[model samples]
Target chain A: MLKVHNLSVNYRGTEALNSVSLAIHAGELVGLIGPNGAGKSTLLKALLGLVAMHAGQVLFEERPLVHQRQRVAYVPQRSQIDWDYPVTAWNVVMMARTVRTGWLRSPNPRSRQAVEAAMQRLGVWDLRDRQIGELSGGQQQRVFLARAIAQDADLFFFDEPFNAIDKTTEAVILDLLAELKAHDKTVLVCSHEWGQALNRYDRLLLLNQRLVADGDPQQVMTLDNIQRAYGENLQPSERPAEMPFFC
Target chain B: MLDWLLEPLGYQFMRNALAVGLLVGVLCPIVGSYLIVQRMALLGDVIAHAVLPGLAIANFLRFNILLGSFVSGIFSTVLIAWIRTQTRVKVDAAMALTFSSFFSLGVLLLRVLGSRLDLMAILFGDILSVSRADVGRSLWVTLLLLLLVKLFYKELLFYTFDPAAAEAAGLPVHTIYYGMMAAITMTIIVGMQTVGVVLVIALLVGPATTAYLLVKQLHRMMLLGALLGVISSLGGMYISYYLDVPSGPAIALTSFAFFMLALLFSPRQGILTRRRPLRKP
Candidate 1:
């Protein structure tokens, strides 16, 4: 289980989140949704210790998340990666084995096999030798996903995994998440996906600078909750006179 | 052709210069390959120039020049990191502001202290006057760099390609980052004697960038870049010997020339002849 208690983050002297708390258990695929600048990504970063929090801490299985980082795999936003880096998909996947392989040594046979399996499972086995820059947006996302899969961690954190990706990559990622959930691994994904894509997650965290709602997809995706989350951006004046519902 | 090549090898000074050139030839490209791939080529230039103040002070005090240069180089690295993180300045902007200002301060201090250091040789290079001790130090530094890369190849590749992921994967990322900075500083400090301060970045960035266009993997890039470095350094030394040119500029020009040739004719990425391999001689 993962517990984030009294989580608050301040960005440039402004509180991005105020006293938000949440808990998630294993075998759960949770989606984090919020408007732009509402701290969906910030919360993930804070939990991973990639960003400093003005208050709060993250615990996994009753221990600090930092100590158990070996079992945690993070895939940053797609925009953060350098596609022109002189590396292939195979090399990207091989990076996940570095920590397990240890210092001053190459990846053992087991680790290599894991990399091969992850790429094969992701349908990127044939493209292993291709440079990342030469890959499509969908393929690039899959490559990073393949790297995460190769980590074989108990926990997975993905930020904006569906942004700008093709439908195929989206389906592949969803299937992988389902597979991970079946194996009792905890998965937290931050995305703006609504409607059908939102149904795949066991739980949805609707956030807008704070925890607006956290519950089942049917309950959390209500009109009231949707309005509360994106209410500021929902301008009633912009809608047609016949359509009364702004959400 | 063999006699012409052997002619320069008879003199001990020429031999020592060639040794220094060879060492630097192998050193710069490997280090530079990392810089180029990470889009941190300017960082290399920054450190190379940042070593100036320490070198000037070392000349003033009459101690080992590399020691002073090293101290100043480390200081600049720390300062750059600090300024970049402490302010809104981006990495490139911070480096630009740091290297230029540090270089100016070094020139000022040199003038204030009235050191007899030849700015020309230090700025360009006088590889002909390289001593045996300098050659030995360059050799050791090259060996040390090679070992560091060999030991941390996997970690470094991950970190350079995607640092956040590397950090998330529980690697000691800060240590790796600082260790790389230290290595770059040491490489520049030792490389001062062969290519001097101004043109040192040429060795650090040019060959690796050329190899980068041709190779698909990091180690292969380093390996091929090293080969190009050695050939260019050796060729530049010969050009200097026969044409009565300055060694540093000659070497830098040779490296740039090689890059131009590769850019136009490389099998994988050449603008003119890409998509087809050249016929073997």
Candidate 2:
């Protein structure tokens, strides 16, 4: 389990996140759904200690997140990566093993096996030789997913993994999430898809620069919570009927 | 043809110039490969120009200009990092700010000191007139850089490609970053004599970019770029010799020509041949 206490993030005199606290337990697939500029990505960065926007500590299983970095895999948004970078799918996946292998040392046979196994699990083994830029959007997502798996992290954080992806990628990610949950891996997925996709998450944390709602999907998707998170943007009638957002 | 080429070796100055040019040829593309991959080509230029003040001060103090250049290079990098952290200004604005101010100070110092041999050496990269000591220094720099690259290639690759993930993996990312900055500064200072500050960026960025269009990996790009760099330097030196032109501009132009050729003719990524997908029918 991971516990974040009184986390706050400020950027250039503006509050991006404020006093947000949450717990992510193992074997749980938590979906972080939020409106634009609601600190969804910032939350991920703060959790990983990649940014200094927050002052609180993030602990996993009673240990600081910093100590668990190797056990934590973060797949950033598609836009955050450079597709044009000169690397192959194999190379990207192999990077997961970089920290496992020491500096100036090549990957051992065991690490290579892990990388190949990760790529094979994601069905990207055949595209190993192709330049990452040449892969389709769905294939690109799979490559990153393979990298996270190759890292063999117990806690997985994916930022907008579904963006610009096809059905195959969505299926691959959903199956992987299910597999990870079965394996007792903690997963947090950030997404904007809220229609039918809202039902997929075991828990939903609706956010708007702060935690607006946190609980089972059916409990957190209330109209009042939606109004709080999307303020003045979603009237009662504007809410999608199938969403079951009770007034 | 061999005799014709050997004629240039007849003169010790020409031999020295050729040796220095060849060393820089191999060095620029190797370092430039990193800059191009990180999309820091502009940063390379900024650092290149930022060395001017150090060169001027060293000339004024009659101390080692190389030391002055290296110190100024580090100072500008620190200032840029400070501005980025302390204010809302990003790396681009900070670089623009530091590079302009440092270059102006160098220009002012040159004016105050009056244009002299040392000033000309930094400004125009008087490669042909390099002393024997310059050749030895360049050789040492080349050897040191190659050794470091060999030792830390994996770490540098991880850092440049995905800095956040590299840090998440706990690789002392900042120390590696600072080490890289120091290496880049050293490269520019050593190269300042071959192409001058104004056109040195071409040597740093051009060959690597050219290799990028043909290679699928960073290491390969570095290898191919270093080859292109050596070829350009040698070719430019010969052009300068036979055509009676300035060696610095000739080398820069030669490197640019290599890039243009790659742009137009690269097998996989050339503009001229986008590799028409084969039809299933």
Candidate 3:
């Protein structure tokens, strides 16, 4: 379980998030939807303690989030990473164990087995030896998913994991998320593709600088909320073409 | 060939110069890899040039060059890191501000100390004139720095690849970063004596950058970088000997030449100088 109370963030005197609060119970998959720069990524960063919170606290399992970092895993936007790094897919997945193993010790055999299983689950086991730079965008997203899986954490925060990914890869990732829910794990995903998120997530949190609405996908994802959050940004023809597939 | 090359090896000064080159060539790339990965290639050049005033002051004080360079390099690193962190000044502006200001101060110091100290010796190294004590000190520092890098190799890679993730994972990313800066400071300090400030950037960036163009793995890049460095050093030393040229420039040119070769000929990502023919344009 995770709780964020009265959270606000400011960057260079510009307020990114203004007194927003939300919570997710265990086993729930919450989709955080918003326009660009609407504090979606900032919320994730604040939860991960990567950003300085102007006010309020983040709690994981009733403790401060920073102290419970190991129990939470994050898959940042693939576009945000330097893909040219010399690390391999295996190395990226193994990085999940870094918090548990610490710097002085290497991952144990069991941890290695977990990493392998996670890679296999995500259909990236064969690509383990390949340099991360060589992978496609979908493959890169899968690698990050494998890393989160290998972390074996109770809660996962993914920032736009499905962006630029094909439909099949998106389905595979959704199925994996369903499996995580079955295992009573928590997932908070930030997605711009409302249709895909609606099909998979248990709850939808529509946001625009503040909590616009939070409820079931049907209740929260109304055209009014979408128009308000998006603000004439969506032309009728520009509405996601993939909504029918999800329906 | 062995007779001529072996003959020079018999001289103490020749041995010292060779040792100094070997140590510098090995150490520069180890630190330079991090610099390149972090997209901070020019930071080395900035730091090397920025430490000139400290070197000049140390020369005026008749202190050891390493001690002065270390202090000055640390000061510059702290200043640059602080400026980048505290103010909105971008990295390049901060580097330019710090490097130019300190370098000018060094010029001023050298002007005042011109009568007693040989500024050219510090600007452009006299590798052939390296004392045995200097060579010993270089060897000791290189060994210590390499050992530290080896011990913390994983942490360094993690920090370089993703600082935010590493910090969230509870690794001391800042500490590792500053520690690396310290290592770089030590490396540049020892390097200043043999390569001088002007040529130190060549050793710091050339071989490592060349290796980066050639390899995809960190460990392999490091090994290839060291190999490239040694080859450049040996080739430059020999070419300087035969052509009666300045050894420092020869070494830097040789390294630059290798970089060009790697840039042109590397298999994976080398610049394709010859464009593919357009199909039925």
Candidate 4:
């Protein structure tokens, strides 16, 4: 379980996240939804301690989350990755074992097996030898998904895993999330998706500089919540194309 | 052919220069591969130029010049990182500002102190004048850095590829970054003697980039880059011995020639000689 208390982040003196607090239970698939510049990615980065927080504390099971980083896995956005980097799919996935294997030593047989199994599970085993840039966009997404799977962490954070991905990758990601939930793992996904696809998550937290709504998908997807999170000036057409919003 | 190759070994200075050159060739590209991957090639140039002030100060105080330059070289990278992080200034502007400031300070110190250090020699290296001690230092440093690199290859690879993920996985990303900067700074210090500050970037970035075009993996790029570096170093020494050119420019030019060759003719990614779809069967 994860608990965030009064987290606030300021970027260049502008409030990016303001006093947002939420708790996620084990085996729950939570989707963090927000409009552009609503700090969805900023919130994830803050929780992962990748970004400095202005004022807040995040605890996993009563201890500070930063100290328990080993039990956490994060998949950053595709824009954050340099696909042209000279690494094979296998090499990218093997990064998961780097911290676990410790320093000054190569991956042991057990680590290697885990990497292989993770890649195979994501249907990227056959493409392991290919340079990551040479793989298609869908394949590239799968490679990172495999990397997250390989981490074998108790909790996982994915940033916009569905953005710009193909149907196959989306399916793979949904299945992985389901598998994690079934295994009692905690997962948080940042997404812009709305409509029936939003139902995939057990819970949704709509955010706009603060926590606007937090509950089951149906409870969080109300028009008032959408308008409050998106903005009062938002046109009907400005809503996510898949979800119709009637004023 | 044997006599032509053997003739350069007759002189002690040539032997020393060639020894230093070979060592530099083996070392620069290996360490420079990280810079290429991280897109921080200019940082190598910054450190190279930044060492001059340290050399001037050390020479003025009658200390070991190498120690002085190494300290300043590493310091320059830290300053650059600080400026980029604490403010809105971008890395390139920060590097340029730090590089020229440190270099200008070095020139001022050298002038005011009236030290015996040769500015021309530092600007454009005189490899043929190296003593046996230079060769020994180069040899030891190369081996030591190579060992360290081998020990931390996995961590370095992960950090270079994705610092955020590496950090989230509990690796000390800042320490890893500083360690990399230290390695690159050390490499520049050692290679500075063979090819002076001005041409050292050519040595650092040239062969690694050449290997990059031909290889898909970081290790392979380093291995092949080291091979190309050695060839360029030795070839430049020979050309300098025969054609009477400056060793630094000769070596840098030789490295550039190899890069051009790879650029044009690499089998996988070359502009020319890439197999067309018709030829792929």
Candidate 5:
């Protein structure tokens, strides 16, 4: 389980996240939904300790998350990665085992096995030798997902995994999340998905510079909560054709 | 061919220059591969120029110039990072500012001190005039760099490819970053002996980029780049010896010629001989 207490993040003197707090139990798949600049990605980065937090702390099972980063895995947005980087798909997945393999040493047999199994599970084993830039967009997404899986961490954080990916990759990610839940792992996915896709998560946290709502998907998708997070300009009930928010 | 190659070895200066050139050739591409991958090729130029101030100060203070060159090089990168992070100024602007100021300071210090160091030789290397001490220093750097790079290959690879993920995995990304900067600084100092500060960036970036056009892995790029760098350095030294040209410019031009060849004929990403498209794997 992960616990965040009064977390605040500031960017250039402006508060990006203010007094935000939330918790997720093990075996749960939680979707963090918010509009642009709503601190969704900032929340993930804060939890992973990738950025300096203005206030408060994040705890995973009683210890500070920053100290226990070895037990966590993060898949950053695809846009954050450079596809033109001269690395094979296999090399990208092997990177997940770098820290665990220890310094001044090559990956041991067990580490190599984990990388191989993860790549195979994600159906990218066939493209192992191919350059990452040569792969399709969906294949690139799958490669990153495989990297996260190869880490074998107890907690996983995904930033915008659904953005610009094909439906097949989406289905594969949902299936993998289900598998993680079955294994009693925790997952926090930062997503921009709406409507039926939101149903895939066990719970949803609507955020707009703060935690506006948190509960079951149907309960959190109320017009009042949507308007509070996405602004009053979107009238979901009156504009059913335009609104893809209702679960 | 054997007679011509053997004729240069009879001279002591040629022997020392050849040793220094080959050592630097192998060293530059290894460190340069990281810079090219991180898209910090310009940083190499910044560090090379910044070394001038260090060299001037070291001469004035009566110390080893290499130590001063290294400290100044690392300091320049730190200052650039600090400016970019603390202010809205972009990295390119920070680099340009740091490079010019340090170079100007070096020039002024050299003139004020009136040291025995030759500005012309420092600006445009005279490889044929190198002493045995220079060869020893170049050899020491080459060994140290090769050892460090071999020991930290995986950590550097992960950090260069995706720093955020490396940090999330508790890989000490910041330490790795500074370590890379140190390695690059050491390389520029060694390379300056053969190609001088102005042309060192060519040795650092050209061969690595040329290798990048033909290879898909970081290590392969380094291996191939080293081979190409050796060819360029040796070829340039021979040309300079035969044609009465400057060693620095000759080496730079040779490296550029190799790069042009790869740009046109690379199988994967060449303008003229593309065997496979970049997409549609």
Candidate 6:
């Protein structure tokens, strides 16, 4: 579980997040949707204690975010990483155990086994030995997810997980998230594809610098809310189609 | 070939020069690999040039040149890191400001201390003139540095590849970052005693970058970089000795030539200057 109150963020004198408050409970898959520069990514980073918060306190399971660091794992935006780094998929996933392993000791057999299982779960076991730079975008995303799984954290923050991924990879990631949810793990995922996220996520927090709405997907994904978040750029036909549920 | 290399062992100067060259060649690339991966090639240049003023001031006060260079390099590193973190001043601009201003101050100091100092040894090192004490000190320092790197190889590799991930992993990314800067300063100071300040950047970046173009794995790149560095250093020494060319420039040019050759012929990312066949319209 996580709690954020009056979380404000500024970038070079420009306010990105303005007094936003929210809570995410355990075992919930919450989708954060907004337009470009909508403070969605900034809010996630602030929650992870990666950014310098202007004014706010983030508590994970009633503990400060920094103190409860090991309980939370983050998968940053794929574009933020330098893809050309000389690291194998295994090495990357193993990094998740670094906090627990400490500086002096290498990953133990147990940790390594956990990494192996995480990689297998993400379907990157065959690619574990490959250099990270050589992996495709989807593979790289899966590698990060494997890292998150290896962390064995109760809470996860994923930024733009579906961006630039193929439909198949997207489905695989969604299935992984579903598995995480089943295990009582909390997930906060930032995404732009509202329609797909609306179907998958348990709760939706629609935002554009300010908190526009927060509730069930059907209630949050409305025409007026979309218009307020995106302004006049919203098209009538662009709203989520009323497709029949198959599952 | 053994006789040629072992024969120089009889002469003290030859022995010192060879030992110093080997140590610098091996040590520079060990640190240089991280520098290249971090895209801080210019940082090496900045540090090399920035140390000049400290050297000049030390010379004016009749202090140890190595000590002076080390102090200045650390100062430059801290200054650059501070500027980047505290202000919106970009990395390149900070590098340019620190190196240029410090280097000019050095030039001015040299002018003021005209004819009172023997700076030729500092400007263009005479490896043949290396004292036994100098050789001993450099060897010990290099050995310690290489040992430290070997011990902390995992941490360094993790930080270089993904700093944010390393931080999230609670690896003290900032401390590692500054630790690397300290290592680079030490390496540059040692290298300056052989290659001089002007050519130090070549030893820092040339071999490692060339190795980068050839290898995918970090360990392989480090190995190949050391190999290239040693080969180039020895080859440059022999060529310079036989041709009576300026040794410093000759050594640097040799590494540069090797870099260009690798650029053209490296298997993975080499530039094929030769024309490709035309596609059908």
Q: Is the docking of candidate 3 incorrect, acceptable, medium or high quality?
A: medium
Give each prediction's DockQ, rounded to 2 decimals.
0.75, 0.66, 0.53, 0.82, 0.82, 0.48
TM-score of 3: 0.92
Query: What TM-score, computed on C-alpha atoms, does each candidate reach?
Result: 0.94, 0.95, 0.92, 0.96, 0.96, 0.92
Candidate 2 structure quality by residue, lDDT tens digits, B1-281: 99888999999888888888888889888988888888888877888888888877787789887898889888888898889988989889898998899889888887887646465556657767776888899999999998999898878887888887788777888798778888889888778887788777888998899999899998899999999989988888888889987777888899888888888888887888668789999
**Tens digits of per-residue lDDT for model 3, B221-269:** 7888988887887677777777877777888999999999888877876
Find the 10 residues in a row with the least total lDDT in model 5 chain B.
Answer: B272-281
Better of 1 and 2 by DockQ: 1
Q: How many backbone clashes does candidate 6 have?
A: 0
Per-model chain A TM: 0.92, 0.95, 0.92, 0.95, 0.96, 0.93
Candidate 4 chain A has its poorest 10 consecutive residues by lDDT at A238-247
lDDT of 6 by residue, B1-281 (tens): 88765665787776787788888888888788888888899899888878887788787788997788789888998999899877899999999999898788877888887636446656665677677887788888889888878878778877787776666656777788888888998898888777777788888898988888888778778889899888777776666566766556767888899899988987767787544579999
lDDT of 3 by residue, A1-247 (tens): 7889999988767898989889999999999998898999989998889889999899988899998788888888876788988778998888888768766676799889999999999999999999999899899899889988998889998999889998778888989999999999989999887564475688989888888889988777666677778886654454554332133
The CAPRI classification for model 2 reads as medium
lDDT of 4: 0.91
On a 0 to 100 scale, what is the lDDT of residue A102 in model 2?
85
True contacts kept of each: 0.82, 0.68, 0.41, 0.84, 0.84, 0.29
CAPRI category for model 5: high
What local lDDT score does residue B27 receive in model 2, on the 0 to 100 scale?
Answer: 89
Per-chain TM-score (chain B), model 3: 0.93
Candidate order (TM-score): 5, 4, 2, 1, 3, 6
Write the residue-wise lDDT of candidate 4 on B20-109 in tens digits: 898999999999999999899999999999999999999999999999998999899899999888888999999999999999999999
Residue B112's lDDT in candidate 5: 92
Taken over the whole model, the C-alpha lDDT of each candidate is 0.88, 0.86, 0.83, 0.91, 0.91, 0.82
Across residues A103-196, which tens digit of lDDT does each residue of candidate 5 receive?
9999999988999999999999999999999999889999998999999899999999999988899889889999999999999999999888
Error of 2 at A60 (Å): 0.9
